[model samples]
Target chain A: MSDVTALHPGDTGLSVATGRTEALTGIAAGLAWLLAAVAAAAFDDLGDWLETQNYAIGVGVFGLSFIVLGLTGRWFPRGAAWVTRAGPWLIALGLVLTLWQLAAAKLGWLPQPFFPPPQGILEVYTFEYEELASHFLASFRLLAVGFVIGTIAGFLVGVSIGWSHKAGYWVHPVLRFIGPLPATSLLPIVFFAFPSSWSASIFLIALAAGFPVAVLTWSGVANVNTAYYDVARTLGVKPLGLIFKVAIPAALPNVFIGLFMALGAAFSALMVAELVGVKAGIGFYIQWSQGWASYANVYAALILLALLCSGSITLLFRIRDRLLSWQKGLVKW
Target chain B: MVAVELRPEQPAASAGASLDIENVSHAFDLDGSVLRVLDSVSLNVEPGEFVALLGPSGCGKSTLLRLIAGLEPPRAGQLRENGQPITGPHPSRVVVFQDPTLFPWRTVWNNVALGPEAQGSLKQQRERVDATIDLVGLSQFAKAYPHQLSGGMAQRVALARALVNDPEILILDEPLGKLDSLTRLTMQSEIVSLWRSKGFTSILVTHDVEEALFLATRVVIFSERPARIKADFRVDLPYPRHRGDPRLAELRRESLALLGLAASW
Candidate 1:
């Protein structure tokens, strides 16, 4: 982001190391997965140990996960690239726990009231990956649809209100009253408002996400310079060309600020939608794992969601940089 | 096609009829009281002549320039060019304010281009911008932003923007007053050279008698507030007058003495 970043050397060595570590971690994960498959298949004894869930064994496995994570953390790349750096910690912890369960089960760390170690959670996550994907698809589809519609509507509404004094006066008061009234609070009312099963989820998600987009767009439009208007008038750039060429470009930087806020709002609304009861998605997977006491599966689901959110935001920032190149060194995304 | 330097012109006789300002007066009513600023001021600037209105602070000298520029209509005077009445700002007449009021966002080149472009999107106007940039000797600073430029450069950009349209008459209201002494001196020489070189009809407003005496064909001195033309002195100094010349200094003392600054000459 040339406009946003002072961009001091940006550490070429760090970037190189980050790339190298990511490749190493990807290879490591691949080897770990192969080892898991072969180790799980070669010994029926280890498989039985995994299926047993003694509380002491579970705690031992969970504790081992953290120790392995704390130790191998810096071996990964980017220092804070989260994607490359976080994966190894997650994989190592998951690995050590897999080993920890088998080791603990054989050592008689469990007595009663609890099943054996990591076998059950692994069985659910590994064997049920297909089942989880289907559920994730349902929530993700609705989130995509809602986010798209909300963003577009918000941009149009915001620009209109910001550009027109009459629109600002007439529309802003009503939106201010409504937008702040938690979108989730309207879920119960929306459940029966539309015909679809996830209508409430879709409506709430769109409402929550669209408000920030509109607010950002309107403020951007409102703040465009009077000098541009005067210049445009003298140049004979009447009505149509004036708004597109002058007003829109001037306001783009502001609109990006709103969209950045809306990204997180969209994700949170998706979470709320899932919590309110959707058949599939990362949220539903989380809820399902909680219900059945599958905590390892829960951790895996949370990691995947974090990865997607981080990736989406990084991508959005890149797009913003490309679009507003004229405004370099103004904002750092 | 590539215009980079102003083409020097031989001094030609002035092109338009002289301006006639008869019985001009101005007043500002502040709160309840009426403050008379200029009273029965009258003067004429002959065609192609360089006239400098010189006076002390609060003598309403700049206000008179603004009135001539048609930025403000005079209360009691009939201001006319060639014999016709003056009205609103026309492309034929331009004013350069003391502060260089060029738009900051645009580059020096675009700022210069604005005058001609504002007229129309005609292809030939591009030629005018190039020619004016050359005229102001700012050919190299065309792409520079105002924030990147020094005060003198910014003022040159402002002048280039004004001159690009090749206005028939220029009313400069203390255009070099904001500059430091060194830059002010440099600007004065540049203004004098450009005026003589282009042979354009010009009216300069200033409080500096030396600047007035050095630059104008006719120096119109004004009395302090409730201002009137106290004296109209013609300076016979040729183009490129020698600085600090005894004769020029004597004229300076004469103009200042009329303003009651120094002992009467």
Candidate 2:
């Protein structure tokens, strides 16, 4: 077994192969820079381009970083380990970017406005960071509030429906009928029912998040091994105690499954909800930029949305790791 | 090593409870058809007696153990402990099933601590949890999750969980059935010693006649499904009985014959 300290790259032993990989990564990065420099110097017909000079500076910085790394990387084993791990991916990314630049800016094979240069996307971050940040924060707030409320409500309803026969008899049919329906299909009703667009959007997001959590939680609670209840009962655990202590803990892996499903649904709902008259958020920004025919801004917003959704999911996974550590090897993720 | 005594602080009078099963009959509904498992079975287990229910596979020995544990009310008869009728499961009667069934989410310590926690006595009986874990020789693994432990180790944790309750009647439903032969032998002695020290009324159900003869004061053999007692043999051996004892060997042969395995033996 590896020692706990091996979690730190500095504490890990390095091989000659790893050092060689790092050197190769540096060479690939340098080659990418050379290609980008030649393309920029040679081509001048890439008209009305935004942040055209910034690409050269970006390539130059990348090349210098790799060259320095190749020379001094062996001295810093931790940094060298990171370089080795990312080496192949870095090489692929460099090659892809070189090809992309050659096709778009140099050859002009792709149509204008449809396929913006990579620098056009980067320029959005530099020029419109404040607007993007505000939209991001707005979207984040709606997601957090909707997710928290939805999950709490789903969990309680699920436990109730699962644990009590009467509750299941009444609630199960209702859930079955409503849970499968798309939350977006109710957008017209949601808009009219709520006092403001924000509340309507929040409602849509909540509805989207709630169904998966409720369904999965219900299944989880229902399918727990009866032996656990038998054990708890023999130990003199009462109904509430049995549910909280035995059933909930046993159902955690399934609950996490529900949470992941909820996240996907919530992200979808947030985008759709924002497009329906919400002035702030990534979804609104996408629609707003598309109206002005700024496809570059649309692409930029899309990239931000991708990062945001993935980041939230990753955060949820980290929480699951902390809470359900006992299920570590049992689950592949 | 001396058998680790359990609940030494509790009064001896409240330690073991006598079990009386009167004309018990049990059946399950299989696709709307009645499948009788145990029929007209009656037995009286004395307080602190170590009794083994020896039967063939599918003979409902485990069903009987579960009845005694009060997991279910018998279909026809009354099961009583210390003159009180058994209506439902209680902490006083605990069963160790063939599968350890330790909550996979809980660590060894939390699993052992469950009884006290359930009974609302965890604050006062906290040390009993630690002591039981130590007695089971799993002190070092108290914080280890159930998945981290081997089959034998998980079974040991299950035993400790029952022992922590200091149950008056400890029901064993082929608790060591899944273990390897070597671990099975070791657990047999461990169980015997625990029973001797704790003085709980132990009802161990096993198909192994030798195992029954080794640890039990009396071996009750059951016939095929719709099970009824075929024979009850009193083992008059002393504590710390050896597997190689000639008397045990003799009784083993007799018990095997009673179990309808004479031709095979």
TM-score of each: 0.61, 0.92
lDDT of each residue in A32-120, candidate 1, tens digit only: 54344334444445324344434334444444443443335466323324435566765675476557544534444554213434555
Off by over 4 Å in 1: A1-329, B1-47, B53-90, B95-105, B171-174, B205-208, B220-233, B258-260, B263-265
How far is each candidate from the true structure, as Cα RMSD in Å? 9.3, 4.4
Q: Compose the digit string of candidate 2's lDDT tens values, residues B83-168.
A: 99999999989989999999988899999999989878888877878889999999999999998999999999999999888789
Give the DockQ (2 decimals) of all models: 0.12, 0.73
Which ranges of candidate 2 are over 4 A from the true structure? Answer: A1-14, A41-45, A328-333, B1-14
Best of the candidates, DockQ: 2
Candidate 1 TM-score versus the reference: 0.61
Over A82-105, each residue of candidate 2 has an lDDT whose tens digit, in order, gives: 656766776676777767777777
Once model 1 is optimally superposed onto the true structure by TM-score, how far is the C-alpha of residue A89 displaced, in angstroms? 13
